[model samples]
Target: MNRRGLWSVRWRSAVVWVWCSFCLLTLASLTLRYIVLYIHPDHDTHRERWCPPEPVESDECYSWRPVLLPHATCGCTRRILIRHTCSEDLSPKMWDGQANSTCDPDGSVRGPQQLVMSISTPFLTPKRLATLSYTITQVNELYRGWVLRVYTRVNKHSLPSLCSLVCAHPNLDVCDITAMSETANTVHHAAWRWGVVGDPLVSTWALRYLHHALLPRDAHALTQFINSNKCWHLMKDHPTHSHSVLGSGLLAGKTSWGLSELTGIRKRILLTRHVVEEEQVFRDMVTPVIGRDVMTHDSLTCYTSAGAVPFPSRRSPGQWVGMPIPTLTNSPQNQNKSHKNATDIMPPQLKVFSVKYNSKVNTTDGFQIIKNQADNDDVNEMEREHINRKNGIPRCPHSCRPPLHPNWDYC
Candidate 1:
């Protein structure tokens, strides 16, 4: 019994040790998973806990608590700025005069008769807020017939600040898409599903099409599209190209510039007089700067010309006509002085507009417009030439003339 019993006991001991080790490892793995999940919860699961299953009018439906980061100060908590209940109505409203108009002789409802322009941005920083406000003022002043709508991502707490910044213009409506769900049956939900998640290239495309679809059949309207980063201004009237769609061509392919063609596509804000019948044709004509087939390198149509709206160019000098021009100074004394007298230096039109809003924003931090050295020099030279011409002096031929001297009257 000595040799056989000893071997059998050793084998049984090995089997028991292996099974105990396996059970311990499994228990440890499950514990670690639970710990990780407790520390950093899944976003979808958290959303489901708060967001209502159906549209609700209560503010509690969109309530969100501030999230504190680990080891961070209590003041450094991250808070969602805007949140709206699913039932909250944020639809665009027609201008006052258009409200009374009928669709046809039969007194039926028609699509939007007024020009509807829209712009979308996920983040609404201070700079974007100012640009948007200024654009709205300009649109209201220049094109009284058009209606502008703004779509951005923000939470309930931050929305009032934005609305106040924009002065809550009647012709413009600001819509928030932060709480939009793809599964919802609302118009915004449909557009949200159409958009490619996390892709900024086509972020505004779906909303633009949605607005067009809501318009009256064969309606004659103009769509002025741009992103939050870009500013739009009416430089001059282009009645010739008013009926046709226009966009930029400088960025047709990836090789054209180091930037993606999609960036150029954002610059291609179309101004169309009539809505097209087909969706594909409408997209192609509305956004000709970048091809519809984003995966392929198909030839893109560029429409940069006199009639086309001027887009910010990475390679060329920036235009100052429609841009905010801020005096640059490093001296703290000068900066303080500039800030104090900001309203005095503003254009008469802007001064008048600002009075209407009674905006509380510090003028010094109103809007920051960035321009390159070449652009600054070009703008300076143009101003000098204008002064000389006004005083009955001829423009100096820079090519033939020597370097400018203090005593020189002409080249």
Candidate 2:
């Protein structure tokens, strides 16, 4: 072949090699992208799957499973708990005749049964359905012996504003309010989620849980969502996954110390490390203090999973969040005797814990208003117990709900 022909062939070969190299690089990049997505599924799609509707109008949230976690923070678990916890005044000074003093007149006070729809937002939780539902079929069975009603646009939002609207219109019943909005079709549509889904099971269950469960659990959910008032960057293990480093937040609040009380915990160690070093950090800092008590360890060490970004993790160190209180020993024999003095408290929770004290059990429960008193206070406690029983009230089982972040799986 001539020199010119040979040079032409070489040039063609070089072009082909460059093209093949580009394609291979593109394929590799795509593969790496897929792997990253698989390891850390984009929570947005998960949020979209779980929250199909707008966050505020999600018919309450789908991910809010009926399962309650052991470390729930408030008496706000199911809708019943929301009604019982959010409505009924927890104050000892609240007179017996006026049980609904703190509750919205148009809301929790008006009906013992309620159904709630909540928006599931990544940053915020629906806090006030004070109601719940399951897959019950019959509509009548669901709302049996309960009043099903739609009341307010303001109620569609939080009660703080609608509550004020209700005071002026005390005579306006839910039917009246719902009817008043009927002609204003758009108004009703936004607030009217009743029978929204054609599915009988979903619709009837929503109705039943709204009323029978006392309140929609969403109400309780909102009550517990104080972990953060507004959505901000989460600096901990995405609130859903279990980890060994936990911390309180400007909004991601702490869990109950009661679980520690019940389980008999003493020393709790919370550690923070670069998100890149999550496993190593847990092994090095937290494991020893927690010993092999897996449950306790997981619950206490929740904040460590902040993503590996250097800037964010620096601000949020893993923390020891539970109250500094005495806990029972691991041994059954010394268990009760170990935490004999639980009276000492850190703060905040001490304000309202007075509601559960029993004279017989000596719950050692304290109140912010009435800390320590003489034997006469025991008489007062007995009187309070009788009043509570008379009212068919029980001490709230949940004052808080479990974490709602996509990472934590109460299910």
Candidate 3:
């Protein structure tokens, strides 16, 4: 071979070797990243570590485990993606940005303040289980500093699946209500009785049980700060009666005072022998504290039989956007049946949108409200863009469009 040809051959061989080496290095980097994320060195240690018991007086001992999401952190860029959605990412603005800045390394927000939620169900069907999982995931994503307490009455067969769901998230705790005699004997019995007879009183008893059971040790401090109510509470109210409709009868409050007031309502319900609704109780408790100024006509719209309605634009800022539960069925027969009543069965998928707040609004008073509104706006914009792209619609360029005139013809 000629000397020039030999030099060309050697150079070609060197390029091929370098390319192979680069590919190998890239593969190794990706593999290491995957291992760091999914198979953490401390994963086994964290899983094996004993969970601390709740500092409360109760026969039923429950422990809380940290919800570990690789993408989520106590910073501006934290995001948690839901499992079954169309790869739609949660808005970083959903959580209070100020709170994020002050968050501890452990992902907890500073101060004695925390959000608490309780979800209970008598039976855990596949559909109900998915809904429960979605709800918990949404809570974890939206409220980073919040603690979710889940109580389920599932059989031994379903226990592992429930545990898998709970263990994956941070700031989440689960208690098998059926496993505890204290709860099983009283609240479980009441729930079953109410399920059969549609007795409102019996249902109220079950709610009361959860209200007290799910409270943190520092629940007493909830009402201490009148102007700056620290603890927020939300409880999922499942249908206890056979005839009751599947609705988002979620009981929520800006402060834990609403939870504490349940005791007073329980006494009132006993004295009057009246069928007092839980929604009515919540409204009576919260209306005075949050004030009539913040509430709109549709503020209590989720209390309706139709489930979660679209949040009105004029509604109070900082209120949670109502998420409609989608009818998720895998069976062909069920899908066909669901399609017939698609309007009724399948509501619009959960979309979090922000409401515009007055610029003059006090930042101290409406910090969370403003943050949520901004988050919703960003999420809504992203969702709209996603839909447009799916439908082959071109997104209008932000540079060409002015903020004041969104519908300008030129844009």
Candidate 4:
């Protein structure tokens, strides 16, 4: 053994020790980051883009919910690769920029991170919610969708004052209010509107004359809106591809769901300012005749003269028993001309009927208007006593009344 050999061995030992120390430190750093990140983890390092399971088709609503994450988490600040159809990667302006972009099968949706209303990083507070609510009222008439309330929550301990303030917010349902304050690293929520209405029923007014008819001319329009359809979709016959339990129930007046089943569904119809915003032919005639407030309210009264209106075959599934229902579809583009002409759109059969509406509830039990063939269509002849009552008409402003003018009936 020589001095040179001894020196080489000592140097090799020192290098190995240094390398081991560096590797141990690096491993520790990564572990800590993993623990800190579970919520809104770094997009670059963690593949936080967990493609959640799509919501199953519910019996109540045509729409489904795909849970984005397990809990409220901050929006991923980094660009996330989204490879799914009908889902945007928490990013905005990705697909909107493409004029004719369809949901591509193999293609992916990508862009800037989608920013949502959260406590931090574009923080939105309780004060903002109230301000937003107030502002909504001002422009509510101008736009159809106005949210009177918002539901959200935050870590009470992280910002107790902000948490308390938000929790106490009126019209807000702040879940998990008592939990310890979470660090600002996490986000809470945002809610989407579903058109479901409570246990509801509609009363149809029956009529026989062609001289004066309310809904006979606009029955299709009323039915369209009542079925949670857009006016334009009603114009020529394009169904929005969405369905509602309330609308379904009203069609048969039998499938009416209990509160539990009804609440499960949200989309009853687009709760726009006007029930029939499209089908312009009914424009000036129907709206002014029937107050907008009454038509759009959660409940509605339908005065059908002649017991039947020219309802789109699709709109009324079981209204006519044993008769094949027509699938009356309209043009999507007709939405453009929806507000155009009122008188020109009515089908002649509708001439024998009319419709009026009331928001007030007439009865807890629903109503159905059956065709009375033997008697005269005049109000007096079609009295409740004279009519054949198979299914009792539901409560209404004028239930079991003859198919006559609203003025004559004072309904």
Candidate 5:
């Protein structure tokens, strides 16, 4: 072969090798790119999935199942001890005497016979719900702590105003006043309180709890929100009660706290007053504790002038939230028997928690007189002061003002 022919073959071989290398590199780059993008997945589309420690098999398929974690904060788990009003004044003369007469109230109060949804997903599972329940309880604790601080600082006459200041603004730091009032109302009128005198401490505790559950957990975040009276950067319409409903079902397995037998002496008496006649005296005694508004209606009465009557309005057949108060150590084991009511698989839950006391955040509102305070400083200045007060830090660097330019021009 000629020299030129030999050189041409060598060059062509070199060119082919280069082309092959380029194609391989391009393919690898594309593969790496796909792996980087697709392997772990993105936050926007991922759903939370908890794999059970052990596998569960049924029918043809098998999957891991989550172990039931006992309700942590509350008392025992075997029987969910609930408070209720069993009897009250049944005299026809009283406002609610007509309806306070039935144990079941035609089932409307029990809510739908079962949980409409399954409790399997991360949203509905025990752990997540327990955490949320804990958070709610913690918030209540913080509110109490704050109230104690305010109460200590001021006298009785000044309490309401200070409470108003602490709870006044519906800003980012605090929960909505309307919601707080509603919770206070609920606690005051709980079945346990029907015929009993009201206790201010219970109201205060409930107020703190419901509000704290809806507010931020971080102290700084809470402080910023409270000072501003709004959810962090939320709009005007953002304070609706639905915020509580958002994760409630997932955590508590249901939204409403089912009002059952009204077991407590006060509540039972109040509830009983509705079904049986001549329980009138009991109702009167209980009325003050639950507040006058609650006493007017019969605990067993299904319907009211307001609308169609539902279940007992209090008791319902829904999954109870959290474990019973005391840790379920050696408590009777609830082995599921075949004949057991399928519905009974999930029992009523009463969640109890150790109170966390944060010395900031107050939550008393409604019936509060609004007042104008002197705006001696701008919002900016107030914000700075707030930061300074919350955390002992200065806004600007210390002792560092800009130096003056001596010569703007040749003097």
Candidate 6:
């Protein structure tokens, strides 16, 4: 061939070779992606599990994870894009301005990172299992979602100090504690209120009441607090004020969640000072009527009347079923009104039946009003007969007779 034709052939061949290599690489990449997709159809760079087939009724899909990177720390400035309909980025106001802000979403990932630890058949470490138990208590405070405790080794080498996500629905059986821990990153320990008795059942009613009654009463403040993301802070910090802030319009507890189901599904977020704080809160609440040590046996007898204080409603707040439950009405705003006048704000004809203050009753009469409720008349009659057979003075009216045993007494 001629020299020019030979060179042209060589160049064309080179060009063809480069093009073929590029096409082959592209095909290989696509094949790899398909294989990965088949294996993990729900994987995401964001670490959130891909949303399964579900009704997309809401504005945004419910994704709990945010891919917390190792770089981000509390109060640090990181560029993260918040995809929620409400905001473009995580604002400084959300974390009480303790964290720095940057509206830029170029690189930073928001929220908790997906736990990368793998799961095995059984966890192998005694020490890590112990630490995991401690970690679960901390995680339960923030994320109340259901998870499983796993105690197994990965690859038979790495110690199992890790928690895995237990989201395998229908595919897996009982979830392990390891799955629960995977949902959170570094748990910054904070002081939480003790034994406030967080029944999700009660919380549902309480939250509804707060949203309807309490929020409406002080609409401006409530709106501001909610908008500024201060409601969570108030709940965590000023627990006493939290009740008033949300309780002014609270309805009574309901019975939607069966006790059996609640016990199984609902998890307890154990806090450090649960019992101590619970006692303090109770003392603060009932101190005016029963005084300190109101949680004692004497106080318990007084609390028997609690059932008679009707709960709000099973569904809606303020909508009574059998009877209306009594709630404290005097917010700091309107505390000086006459007790009788305060009834105007409350449901008319509703009374705190079967509940009476010892302070409200006089103790002078031997034939005082029967302390036993009218509902217990049969039991009272039996007691009366027994008392008469013994040494009986006439039945003590409006109260139960003192037992002959010196140690036994009623408050």
lDDT scores of the candidates, listed in order: 0.32, 0.26, 0.34, 0.26, 0.24, 0.26
In the range 14-95, model 6's lDDT, one tens digit per residue, is 8899999999999999999878877985342222112112234465544343322322212223222232334434442343
Model 4 residue 238 distance off true place after TM-score fit, in angstroms: 33
lDDT pick, better of 4 and 5: 4
Question: Where does model 5 exceed 4 Å of error?
Answer: 1-127, 138-213, 216-411
Model 1 global lDDT (CA atoms, 0 to 1): 0.32
Query: How do the residues 1-411 of candidate 2 rate in per-residue lDDT, one tens digit apiece?
Result: 545653787888998999999999999998987787778653112111111111333343322212221112111222211222333353323223442311123233332223232111111112222111111111112222222333334333444332322232222123222233333233322222222112111111121112222111112122223222221112221232233243211011111212232112111111212233433443453333332222211221233332211110000111112222122123434322312122212122321232332221221111011123222233444565565445333332121113332221111
Candidate 1, residues 1-411: lDDT per residue as tens digits?
655653787888988999999999999998887787778653112111111112334556663223222111112222211223355432222122332211111011111222334445555654444445545554544344344455555666556555563344444544444433322213332222222212221122212321111111011111221212121212211122223332211011121111233333322221211223222333563234322212110111113322232222111121112123342333445323312233533444345434533432222212212233223333345665565455434532232222333222232
lDDT of 6 at 398: 20
Tens-place lDDT digits, model 4, residues 207-322: 11111122211232333333441111112111110132112111211112223323332122222233232123133322232222122211113332212222321111101111
Point out the worst 10-residue segment of candidate 6 by lDDT.
307-316
**Candidates sorted by TM-score, best first:** 3, 1, 2, 6, 4, 5
lDDT of 3 by residue, 1-411 (tens): 555654787888998999999999999998887688576643222121121212333432322222224322222222222211233223333234433211122222211234444455666665555555555554443343455555556577666555555455555445444444343334432232122111111111112222222111112112122123222223222222213221223333332323334444434322322233433433464333433212111223224422221221222212222223445554645433422222222223332221123332233321222334323443355565565445333433333233454442111
TM-score versus the correct structure, for each prediction: 0.29, 0.21, 0.35, 0.18, 0.17, 0.19
Worst 10 residues of 3 by lDDT: 196-205
Tell me, by lDDT, which candidate is best. Answer: 3
* Predicted candidate 5 versus true structure: per-residue lDDT over 229-339, tens digit per residue: 111111111112223311111111111111231223334333432223213433343222222111111111112211111111111111111112222222224321221
Measured with C-alpha atoms, the lDDT of residue 289 in candidate 2 is 32
Model 1 stretches with alpha carbons more than 4 Å out: 1-111, 165-167, 179-411
- What is the Cα-based lDDT of residue 39 in candidate 4? 55
